[model samples]
Target: MTKDPTIAIRDCLAEIAVLHGIAAQKTLHEFRNDAVARRAAAYAIQTISEAVRRIPEDWLADFPTEPWGQIKGIGNRLRHEYFRVDDGILWEIMTTDMHALKTVREAMLARHAGAS
Candidate 1:
């Protein structure tokens, strides 16, 4: 059976949140120095971006507060240009952008849950 897109999005968001939380405790220097941590964070980000790309455009359109295009672009960049990924950009994205995305994701999940 096909999974509901809404549920898939929620799951992805939850995963992103967990990954962010795991990385949150470590300093930027730690993240930069630890290849394992960096890879884990990168994978989580790529996963979230991939899921965001799969979400229906109409549903995404409803969330004007989120940066949908940029999210998708990040996924594309990560997928296509893995070798060129910059640690500083990843740090900025994880620290700032992910929080905004998580807030939007939570709101969307809540709204969907209410509708159901």
Candidate 2:
């Protein structure tokens, strides 16, 4: 069985994203003030961004269902507009946005795994 690059990247990213979500949920209260939680959340977003960035164009083409561009766009915004980021938006993204991403990741993973 040939290993697909897109699936590999997606699986790796999904795992990290799940970890980030878990961490974010665990520190929902403390994240408002705790430096560690803030940093961790930032790092989590960064990693998710990196995953999106690393996805090759060909691989992106294969997964029509996933919001590859949007995910990367958010990452670009976060990376470029660090100081201008609003906490409320970030909180909403972490909670609501991440769940949507999680669904996409799961669907892609299931499809790829089934294909294999």
Most TM-score-accurate candidate: 1
Structural similarity to truth (TM-score) of each candidate: 0.86, 0.65
Going through the candidates in order, what is the number of backbone clashes in each?
0, 0
Deviation (Å) of 32 in candidate 1: 0.5
Tell me which residue pairs clash in candidate 2: none
Alpha-carbon RMSD to native, per candidate: 1.9, 4.0
Total backbone clashes of model 2? 0
- Runs in model 2 with CA error above 4 Å? 1-29, 56-66, 114-116
The deviation in Å at residue 8 for candidate 2 is 5.1
Candidate 1 residues 17-80, lDDT tens each? 7667756778888888988877777788888888887676777887977778887788778888
Q: Model 1 misses residue 76 by how many Å? A: 1.9
